[model samples]
Target: MYIDLHNHYLPAVDDGVLKIEETLLGLKLAIKEKVSTICFTPHIWSGRYNNSPEKLKEVFEKVKEEAKDIKIKLFLGSEVYYSSTIAEDFSKGLYLPLGEKKKFLLVEFASAVMPQGVSDGLYKLMLEGCEPIIAHPERYSYVQKDYECLFDFAKAQIPMQVTTQAIMGMLGRRAHRTAVKLLDEGLVSFIASDAHSPEERPLLFREAVRFLNRRYGYQTAKRLAIDNPKRILEGKSLLPVAGRKGKYSPFQ
Candidate 1:
């Protein structure tokens, strides 16, 4: 049983499941993959997909009602696009956190260029008592160029979440390489299925967990897939991961 901290299964909210049928299909796939808990993190960009907290709650309720009979649990959050004003907007209650506790916020940066005030922006959020979890940092070209910046974020106790498909090589070579490097270096805190649709970005929790176990041992796999995410939901601090020497070597 894994808790998926990042997913886009809510119907018609963002770039996720477009209709109710698609939402149900995505939930079914998640359940099949042993994902007991899922966080519906639709995109919340400033001028693009501008989803407010109240609006998201209404949409979440509708989707929740539609999938009420499904055994899997549902949650509401936003994969917020990072901007200098994010902290200010969050202060005004413009966004939703990963869970009810509101301890962690899932954030993403632009793919081409890293924002100038990115670090300061995240710091401001932290000052407001919200831990920012950088989503798919490996996918960002800036991060790919200077991964040590990721280490800096991790050192500051800000967590980084990598998508499962990236590790599985479904997102191509650069993403796959970065994901592996981050995992091997122990910079990643959570491994989540950023599933959008049933067919396109289906939940691969079972496969991801199995691969992590086989390549990195049960401890590392379990921590990324289950333990750490559970802690995040519970509003607790995560344990640090020790970096391994060789690539994908089993934990000693």
Candidate 2:
């Protein structure tokens, strides 16, 4: 079963689904893509979205109840926007983990600039026994300016996720090129459908998986689409890719 670690299908939470019908449509598309488990990751940006964990849980329960007959398991998480006080917020339970294991937290960086003290915050989270999964590193402007920053992140043992749409080149040429580079460099830990709605950013897991399998190989595709994500959910160490040591592997 494929596990989607980053998605926004919950109704009226953030910039994801605005209504119950849209949420159900997104779920149907995910099901068609052979997704068995999905994590509904709403944006948790302070001073903007401000999605509290308690409120997220309440919305998740409602979505779960509505999606009861879909045969897909739903999990609650947050695509936490990175801030200077992230480590403190995480300790205060301001963000949700990837799954019930509570080992990995899905995080996003600012689009305009890399936030101050992000590296230190990530290191602190690691020291506190929490793995930080950087969501869609390919979309960030600084990393686009310097791809070597991704290597630095890898050296710091920070794992990354690339959106399926980015890989498929739907977002734009630059994002597509960056995603390909990250995958080729063995820096990406997961490939997820950051699906927000059916009309705009729908789930493209099946196409993305096929592309990975054809371009890279079956094992590489499986590692990003399945194995690594499962490991994250199970709170186990991810397998090494491209012969890298300790850190999660990408394509070999």
Candidate 3:
């Protein structure tokens, strides 16, 4: 069993699943991959998604009610797009933390650029008692060009989640390369599905774990996919990963 801390399975709220049926199908599919727990993190972007915590909660409750018999645990949260006012917004209940613990916030940045003062903003969020989990840093253009930016995040003690698709080379080559590099450097704290639809971004949790086990060893794979994510839900500190040495080969 593993925990998927980021996903867009919540229906009709964002660019994810559009219907309750899709949500159910996604959950069923996730279960098939041995995903025992999931956090329904819908997008909470500023202009694009603009989903409110209350609205998301309402939708999540309905989804929980519908999927109660699916033999999987479900929780509610949001993939908050970065903003300068994140701390203030979180205080006003404008954002939802992962698992509602009010401790960890799953955050994403622009795909093309790393915003100015984002590190400062994330630091301020940490000061306000929310540890930011940088979601899919491998997919960022800036990081793809120079993954060393993630060193700053690691130095700040910020955790990161690399999506299963990126590791599987389904997103793109740069993403796959960066994701593997992050893992090699022991910078990634979690591995999540980030699944959007049952067909498009289906949950590949088991496959990712299998791949990681074969490539990086089983303990490392389990740490990212299971142990660390469980720590987030429990409001505990994440374990530090011991990075593997040597350059990464795609087919290795």
Pick the lDDT winner.
3
Estimate, for each residue in 1-252, the C-alpha lDDT of model 3 and write its tens digit.
899999999999999899999999888888889999999899999999989988988888898899989999998989999988887887787989987465899999989988889988988888888889999999999999998877778777888899999999999999999998888877888899999999999989988899888877878888889999999998899887645753331222
TM-score for candidate 3: 0.95
> Worst lDDT window (10 residues) for model 1?
243-252
- RMSD in angstroms, all models? 2.7, 2.7, 3.4
lDDT-sorted candidate list, best first? 3, 1, 2
Where model 3 places Cα greater than 4 Å from the true spot, the runs are 245-252
TM-score of each: 0.95, 0.94, 0.95
Could you give candidate 2's per-residue lDDT for residues 21-132 as a string of tens digits?
A: 8988888878888998998899999999989999999988988889899888888888999887888888889999988798999999987688887889888877768899
Model 3: how far is 116 from its true place, Å?
A: 0.7
lDDT of each: 0.85, 0.85, 0.88
Off by over 4 Å in 2: 243-252
After aligning candidate 1 to the native by TM-score, how far in Å is the CA of 229 from where it should be? 0.8
Q: Mind giving the per-residue lDDT tens digits that candidate 1 earns over 1-252?
A: 999999888888888889989988888878889999988899999888988888989988988998999998888888999989989988999889987787999999989898888889999999999999999988998777878767557667788899999989998899988888888888888899888888999878888888778777778888899999988888898866544543332221
User: What is candidate 3's local distance difference test score?
Assistant: 0.88
Candidate 1 clashes between residue pairs 3 or more apart in a chain or in different chains: none
Instruction: Tell me how far the alpha carbon of residue 117 in candidate 2 is from the true structure, in angstroms, after superposition.
Output: 2.0
Better of 1 and 3 by lDDT: 3
